[model samples]
Target: MSIDITWGRGDGAASVSTVAELDATLDTISRAHTEHLPYCVTLIAPGRGEFPVMLDICIGHPERSFVYHVAADGSSAWGYQPDLEPGPPFTFDYAGSPTDAWPERTRVTDATARQAARQFLTSGGQRPPALTWETVE
Candidate 1:
């Protein structure tokens, strides 16, 4: 998941804001993923005001990935789910929909995921994989 940024690319191949916290969350959730929790949920931008963020989780239990859109307050909604298919992994409509789905997507790692959250909060409705979420919370 590579996003075209104009301000130049960042080092470590991750453009997120909080690396330590995101890593901690990922580490905590990775353990949960192997446990009974099939969903393997993790906190993307937890405990924020009415800003807006997105959470994408890839679980190994059922072998599926989920995308969620969370608002600034405390509201959340589904973004895109690929139906758990294995045929070349279809590209979900993350941008340019009647609904503001997650238009901006980040890498499927802890650092990138945090960067994605920051982008979502500051996106204000941008392009590609960033239109999946609306202003709910």
Candidate 2:
């Protein structure tokens, strides 16, 4: 499956198309956090398929930890606290919602996704850090 993975801290974000790259980026972010540097890493991976799958990782706040999966038919399931062993079961919340759901709701293209993520990183009276981005095929 082709997965578009985007990750970054503060205003800087990058995208990788391979699983290995994703792992390396996550490791780097984790190391920085371990050193007590206040940083937030947001990963947005959108899959192309009949039922498009999307995985988002917001690593910083334990309470904000979640995994969202949406099927081809606009059906979706999500879970919280993914860092925990035996992560919570996925819950469905699209029973009677509009046709346009997540990723779609926010316009899931690379440009828009990156913009939204950067916005989130700098929101709430936070300072914008120098941002760097890279794309891999």
Candidate 3:
């Protein structure tokens, strides 16, 4: 979902003031190469026990594309990621959106991360009966 839509909950966990802080942290936690993984986070929400939700923007767009979902705090965030293409038709639904653009040789990357993000948001997490890791939501 669009982070600008403004999540109605979790306002206290944000410690970073800018997207840089959040992105840098995510970079460290992420095992994917910085070149391949361009998705950087901004705000953060640590759950009491479950994964935290993040609020962030894309490095290039700085507008429409922002992520808001229940993901693990740090780089291990469990969330969705769409195909990120450059120029025109810039929207969160596009940039950061997932596609079949990945390769079959990759083994060390966190392949399931994007799909996880998609499921969580669609289910309206932070509520009861969280989405399962298997279902498509």
Winner by lDDT between candidate 3 and candidate 2: 2
Q: Candidate 2 versus the native: TM-score?
A: 0.37
lDDT, model 1:
0.36
Worst 10 residues of 3 by lDDT: 127-136
What's the distance in Å from true for residue 119, model 2? 28
lDDT of 3 by residue, 1-137 (tens): 22222211231122433345434434453333234433433443444445555433232222223333444433332222234322233222123443222221111123233322333334333321221211114
* lDDT to native, each model: 0.36, 0.36, 0.31
List the candidates ranked by TM-score, beginning with the highest. 2, 1, 3
Clashing pairs in 2: 12-131, 51-72
- Alpha carbon lDDT at 43, candidate 3: 40
For candidate 1, lDDT tens digit of each residue in 1-137?
Answer: 22211111121112334435444444554464354332323333333465534354433333234445555555666443222222223222222111221223221333333354445434532211632433334
Q: Give the per-residue lDDT digits (tens) of candidate 2, residues 72-113.
A: 445554332212333222221122221222321221222222
Candidate number with greatest TM-score: 2
The C-alpha stretches of model 1 lying farther than 4 A from their native spots are 1-17, 40-62, 73-76, 81-137
lDDT of 3 at 61: 28
lDDT of 1 at 22: 43
